[model samples]
Target: MQAFTGSTLYAAIGGLHVGDMLVQLVFFIILLILVKKYAWGPIIGMMQKREEYVANEIEIAEQNRAEAERASKEAAEKLRQTKEDAQKIIEDAKHIGGKQEQEIIESARQEAERIKISAQEEIKTEKEKAIQALQDKVASLSVLIASKVIEKEINAEDQEKLIDEYIKEVGEER
Candidate 1:
């Protein structure tokens, strides 16, 4: 019965006055609004800026990747061209060497032919001179034999008659 009496002591003990509860509720709402305005706005803005910076970095990396690929392709093409040029140069050198070898062989053949012709001409000239010398020697030997035979066998009168007969025989033979 004393506990149930309606007085300041009972009100405090029960914890149920309408005016105090309403005032506490209003203060709590004001504190929530202030925290939203002062603390949450800057944090949201900073997050947005960070997201934009990350996106820009990704784009730059993609561009650099594409440039590197292009440079690599160009280098590969240049290497192929250099190999082709080197092959062509080797082929040209081989062709030139073959042509030079042929030219050398031809020149050697021409020189051999010239030497053969000169040797043949020299042999022919030597043969002609030898034949002429042999004929002259035979004519002089025949003259000497005839003179010795006539001196051993004939008088002056017989020599005169033999000379006349020889002249007649020579004219008939001719």
Candidate 2:
């Protein structure tokens, strides 16, 4: 709305302070140079160190995961092997038990056989003694009958009575 004039625009912004503006500019340039020289390298070094630390941590995590997987696999394999060994031990125990059972049965059977043989031998010996006693009884009976008959003739009834008396005498003596 007003007439265009350079001086009036400059006066509105306080343009006579241009020398102060230049001094402020020079001060800003010096500040920037000082910050770049004194602070930038340490800040960059700190950032690089942080990056390397993070990368190392990630690599360690990966290695730990792999180690854990390998350990788990090894544990599983050991478990399988332990189970197999236990099975083998069970089988061996069963085999030993069976063998012992068989041995015990065989021993019992042999003992029974020995007992039977001993009993048979004893029976045979008893039978022979009984037969000998019978022969002796018969011989004594014959001799007594022959002597009685020679002394006096015996009828059938007398012969029967004599035999009964001899049997009684033999039984009492034994």
Candidate 3:
């Protein structure tokens, strides 16, 4: 009967043993807080710096993408402008060639007109000379015919008088 009462007393006192367990739990929590304060600050700072670096890299990549797009647009504009300039140059060349051709044609026409005028002048001069020669020949033939007719009709005394008058007219002309 006494052994049974001692066991019952032990069971009643078991609740008081939980006081030591609570003290142990409080000590563990204090140790955890001290370790976090000393060790965790640098780790968290390193993680924050890593995150900022990654964010900066993403920003740089985005900027590079925008720059590439701008360069591509500039290149396209340059190509288009070059093509337009080339077309304008070709048009200008064509216009200049056409103007030169027109000038050449006009020059050729003027030269031909001058040549035709020169040929006409030469022909007119030749015709005048031929007419003068024909007139001289006709005068000589008429003189010959008149001399023959005079020789057949005139008498000796009249021939002598006519000869003397011709000599007097020739001397006056000289």
Candidate 4:
């Protein structure tokens, strides 16, 4: 090979077809412009839309989670309130039951007292009737003795026989 010089190198490079290079470069620029306008722009826009959709879905999921938590809290509060109400109802029922028991006991006591008082009154009335009957019998017996004494003067033996007969009659009537 001959030693290269700057001028010779320039002549060699210049020997290529400049018009063909210029035409290929222009076509390449046009292809790049078409790709950017028709393919690249749409692809980038689709990607942006996909990103926005994913972000929106995530936000909705977060909101749903918060709503679920709030509902759970509300349910817990309602349960607590229901428990309190149930406890209160039980307490009230117990109080009412105790009051009714006390009333029943008091009523039974009063009834017993009344029964006792009625029995005592009945016994007293029966005793009074027995005493009155005994008094009438004694009065009749005294009148009979007076009439007998007035009818005749009795000796001791006759008096004893009369007494015995009166006793037998009184026993048979009883």
Candidate 5:
């Protein structure tokens, strides 16, 4: 290599110089002061705003989750209530149906008894009418026979005796 020179970097391609180093240091110090005054505070404020926004979103999400849980619990309770109501309605219907069925059966039984009694009464009346008709026919026959016998005898006493005898026969038959 060549001998080291007193001109420093002026004598070499990549060597550092004192004057350039001093100017670089001064420029770096000014740039650092400008960034701290004009850029650093705003950047920090933007970062803080982003952090607050993220926190707010997390809180909202938690509230939504709690609301969803509460709604689900209410729905479960409502379902239980609806089922109970449905069961109560079914029970009431069954009870009403049973009562109605009993009433209908009782009514039918009463109607049947009334019809049976009516039929019995009609039969009794018809039997009495038949007996009366038979009695009338026998009385007429006895009167005619006694009248014919009396005509042959040609006596009032015999006619009355025959009529009494025929009447006694009719009574015996009855």
Candidate 6:
């Protein structure tokens, strides 16, 4: 506990070198200014450029993704349209096939009917021919029997006329 006079306090604080302290403070401020102008300025500029690049890349990626989604939707719509077209075509084909089948059946039925009518006409013609031959044979037998019984010969024209008249009479009786 000695008395702290100005001279004794200065001696106790190791003689207080103000000039050296001021010189050291000025150098430290100069060092800080140099670091701010050279190193810190470049570092801040590089960080800003890197941020802008990253943002641009993100925007491009988002645009690409949206385009991909639009393309996928268009492809799906085209596929649906194609399927509808195919279904319509199949239905039309079936309808056409049914119509053709009906036409074929009708044609076949008409052909069969025509054949049946032709066969009936042929049978009628053959029957008429057989009946005509039978009438001729009967007329010949009648003429032969008449000639044998009368012992007279008749002319051809007279025999034919007689047979026609007899056939007419028989038809009228029936």
Q: How close is every model to the real structure, measured as TM-score?
A: 0.60, 0.78, 0.63, 0.70, 0.68, 0.64
lDDT of 6 by residue, 1-174 (tens): 788998886788799867788999999999999999999999999999999999999999999999999999999999999999999999999999999999999999999999999999999998898788778867876776587547756678776776777677657744
> How well does candidate 5 score on lDDT at residue 166?
77
lDDT of 4 by residue, 80-143 (tens): 9999999999999999999999999999999999999999999999999887876777678768
Q: List the candidate 6 regions with Cα displacement exceeding 4 Å.
A: 1-29, 145-174
Error of 2 at 163 (Å): 1.3
Question: Number of backbone collisions per candidate, in order?
Answer: 0, 0, 0, 0, 0, 0
Write model 5 residue lDDT over 1-174, tens digit each, in one string: 867667754757566777898999999999999998899989999999999999999999999999999999999999999999999999999999999999999999999999999999999999999889877877787678867876796477976887787778767866
C-alpha RMSD values across all candidates: 10.6, 3.0, 10.6, 5.2, 6.6, 8.9
**lDDT comparing candidate 2 with the true structure:** 0.91
In model 4, residue pairs whose N, Cα or C atoms come closer than 3 Å (at least 3 residues apart or on different chains), thus clashing, are none
Stretches of candidate 5 exceeding 4 Å from the true structure: 1-13, 153-174
lDDT of 4: 0.90
lDDT score for residue 25 of model 3: 92
Candidate 4, residue 104: Cα displacement in angstroms equals 1.5
Q: Rank the candidates by lDDT, best first.
A: 2, 4, 5, 6, 3, 1
Off by over 4 Å in 1: 1-39, 140-174
lDDT of 1 by residue, 9-54 (tens): 5577686767787899899889888878997788888889999999
- Model 2: worst 10 consecutive residues (lDDT sum): 9-18
Would you give me the overall lDDT of model 5? Answer: 0.88
Who is ahead in lDDT, 4 or 5? 4
> Weakest 10 consecutive residues, lDDT, candidate 6?
165-174
Query: In model 4, how large is the Cα lDDT of residue 171?
Result: 73
Q: For model 6, name the residue pairs that clash.
A: none
